[model samples]
Target: MSQKRNIFEEVSDEARDEQAVQPGMIDRGRGGARKAIRAWLMVLFGLVVAMIVVGGLTRLTDSGLSITEWRPVTGALPPMSEAEWQSEFDKYKQIDQWRIQNQWMDLADFKEIYWWEWGHRQLGRLIGVVWALGFFGFMAARKIPTGWTGRLFLLGALGGAQGAIGWWMVASGVTQGEGMTSVASYRLATHLGLAFVILGFIAWYAYMLGRDERDLMQARRAKEAKLFSLSTGLMHFAFLQIIIGAFVAGIDAGRSYTDWPLIGGQLLPPDMSVLDPWWRNLFESPGLVQFIHRCAGYLLFAFGVVVWLRGRQSAHPQTRFAFNAVFAALSLQVVLGITTVVYAAPWHIAIAHQLLAVILWALILRARFLSAYPVATSVRG
Candidate 1:
């Protein structure tokens, strides 16, 4: 039997090792530079949040129209000399905001407001530069993960479009004949809505990159589809509420009704139809706009509760904790919203409310990401 042994009966260890398959190109390079990419995204996220806060301050201080021009390239340097400052001020004087509302502002006053808007625009420029350098640097180094080139480029494109839209919003109020003192309410809402959208994409990408590619693949098999769907709906609802809040800010609606649970001591504000045309009241009427914002807040809170209940049933403790954080932020947001209104949207309270909205949005997104790629736990743990 030993003398007649077949060659297939046994194989050497080296032969077996030689026949083993290896990972393909896609698998081998699946998660390139994940940690570095996430770090870059987080930096962008912080800048966007700062941009939002500065923007809100500009609007509150009636300084958004101070620049009066959108010179994307040359605007980086502020007015350097008295003559340049005067020239810039002259351009601002042509706008209705100057003619109608800021007649009291001298050059010194103008400089103060100018600095606010200037800082906002400067921050925007900084974000663009950071994005460009990071993205191309990654590409040049061949460190970007597969399927991520287009995703990263999209951020820059959207940012460019946002700059154009910012000008569009400013143009609405810079007119000579329309008698406009501020940007159109709908345009403001549009501008703000896009910011939230951009912020959301950054946050989601960061969350995805937080885990290893193999881990994400395995986690996807255990995805809670229903919970993910619910969280998605909740995200949209929250975004809608943010847009409504922008409209409220656009027309100074928060100051119109300092009383909560009642508008001017009534369930509904009186004279909602005071604005021309029936539909105009929805966006143009302070009383009506604030009323709608209040109602939306209530509905958002209710929907959040339902989503939290669903999230609590998740099998993973990490997912459960994510949802709990979301619910906590949502509750704090509601309280801040009320405080903002009762105090008539003071700069401190209003800014705090807006900041909390950003936090809540990020938390909801984190919970949704967990639903899609939940972390696994052992029975003993």
Candidate 2:
């Protein structure tokens, strides 16, 4: 049975035809949107770099444990007066880090470290507010793409978790040791790892979202399989190195064994057994930590070099450059690490070493991301 088409149906069909004839940009409005997203990402990137630097200083000055309490909303504002400062100091004194490790440490010294941790927390709060405001502004403007807002939300969630984790890290020392001041190496590693992951995610997403319209959905999504896997593997290896490096920092291992190429002129430092089960010493013993950091450094350098050469052969200059940057930055990181150790981890060199580690982390993250979607290789030509 054939049905006659009504005027309404005919007009609907015509409307559909008109829509189908619209320009590509009208159909896919990603071009301009991408540029705006990119500008946002650059701003975020700067914030993250600042966070990393402040965090490094926090770690360097042993100020990370200064703020014993975690108050999400109220903590953003620093203590208001002398009374407020004393009140905060009183709370800190109850913590084991004060009663035991830093016993008799005057209020003046306490204020010094407290201020650093306070600034770090305040910056964190500012970042949260800025991101929230910006995200809402973008959403209202309809600038964010579908499938990505959730990821951005995830970043915000991670920031929240980070604050909790920072407290979790501080709590460990408070419970076990008296004013011990030093936190567990593992906790420090976790803190650092989370920070790196969050920063990397922000950077990677920005790079993807900011490309020009003519470039957004081009040929690059093709090789996501192999390059992505390779870059991810390399990043994993680098993270392991970073964790080992933390172990070194935790025990102040650099101040002891400055000799390189071989730890103390031997494959392993002598008397490397203390924690009963032998393996435990690797975590608790300064000598073993130094030994591990040195070995990890070699593997990190080698792994990055291989990735660079391999990326160069893939016909993607960004991929190659990422690897090259990773290799070079890592090499410089090694030199800095050695100098830091040889000089007994002086404040300047120590700070530089930490900064370079941040740079190395950034490079490795770039390699992982660019490899996932190599822009140069996806040319439509």
Candidate 3:
């Protein structure tokens, strides 16, 4: 108090005090980076959903096997000239799918299916480019938040693997000669299953990044363990149902049975063991596969009800609402599934059913997330 402070020393002391008061200022940059990455991921999520819808159309149109070769780099370009188009068509003609099922298809007919498959592949390539550009751009600028680079990279890796799996699925139909017109049911299931897995990761990451890291950590302490576990089971059950549904789609099993609450007018449809091996019937027999899918749907709905009951008991309104949405979507999807069956799985109705699965999947994930990191709400509600 006796000594006079230097002007420079006083300024430095004030600056240090300011820094101490706003320690989080240093982390603001990271937070901003996380927000940007989340926005980018949201874009990827939309593209993926488009890809799924387009893929559904592709399968419905019987266009998945139009392209016989897997050229990740060179195949992006569609046929540029008549000669090129003929060359591609010739290649397609050599495949079993073309020789047996589509021999009557002319160049014009081939072009239609070609465009669907080509467009689907093109969209995939675009997704890869977007991911690469965003990830590398962030890496170059050193903007990616801590503990996130690996997760982003994992998405890219899975995407790359998905491309290979797509080829694998296509090859199943192409390789088999005479009487084989579609890909193996199990292979198709794998391809679709992976797609859902990728979509789930994107959604979960986006949701997590929407909130502050500290807030999420704090919310975790109040996690509803029972509800979380039930939701977890529901998620897995839903995924299994999706895979089973894929098997049904793979062989047009949904079209095989139009009657619900009964299969072919019986608890179990006849000819389930028409295939040589009993296990093969599970995947190859239309009646057996459809039966399993129906049973799984009922079980899934029952389990969803149980989970919703537990979720309703949560003190948090947002968490409760999340589960409510899940139940509502689940119920609607069940109705859609039934309608699709009653209508004999027409392309329009079937595609709508598939898209609803996407919605239900997202809602389930959101509900599970809320269970784990519930949003705090007032007690008055």
- By lDDT, who's the top model here? 1
Ten-residue segment with the worst summed lDDT in candidate 3?
23-32
Sorting all predicted structures by TM-score, with the top scorer first, yields 1, 3, 2
The pairs that clash in candidate 3 are none
The residue-by-residue lDDT of candidate 2 on 196-299, one tens digit each, is: 88877887787676565445555456465676777788888887887887777776787768777667778788858967897889887888888778878878
Record all residue pairs in model 1 with backbone atoms less than 3 Å apart, i.e. clashing: none
Give candidate 2 misplaced runs (Cα > 4 Å): 1-32, 175-179, 212-216, 221-227, 377-381
Write model 1 residue lDDT over 1-381, tens digit each, in one string.
346658678877997899988655344877789999999999999999999999999999989989887899999999999999999999989888888888888899999999999999999999999999999999999999998999999999998898899989988888886789999989999999999999999999999889877788889999999999999999999999999999999999999989878898898899699978899999989999999999999999999999999999999999999999999999999999999999989998999999999999999999999999999999999
> Candidate 2, which ten residues in sequence have the lowest lDDT sum?
26-35
The TM-score obtained by model 3 is: 0.93
Q: What is the lDDT of residue 259 in candidate 1?
A: 86
Model 2 TM-score on a 0 to 1 scale: 0.85
For residues 1-381, what per-residue lDDT tens digits would candidate 3 score against the true structure? 667778776457766787776546445655648889999999999999999889989999999989989999999888899999999999899888887789899999999999999999999999999999999999998988877889999999999999999999988888646566878788899999999999999999999998877778779999999899999999999999999999999999999989887889999988689998789999989999999999999999999999999889989998999999999999999999999998999999998999999999999999999989998875665
Looking at candidate 1, the ten consecutive residues that score lowest on lDDT are: 22-31
Question: How high is the lDDT of residue 34 in model 3?
Answer: 80
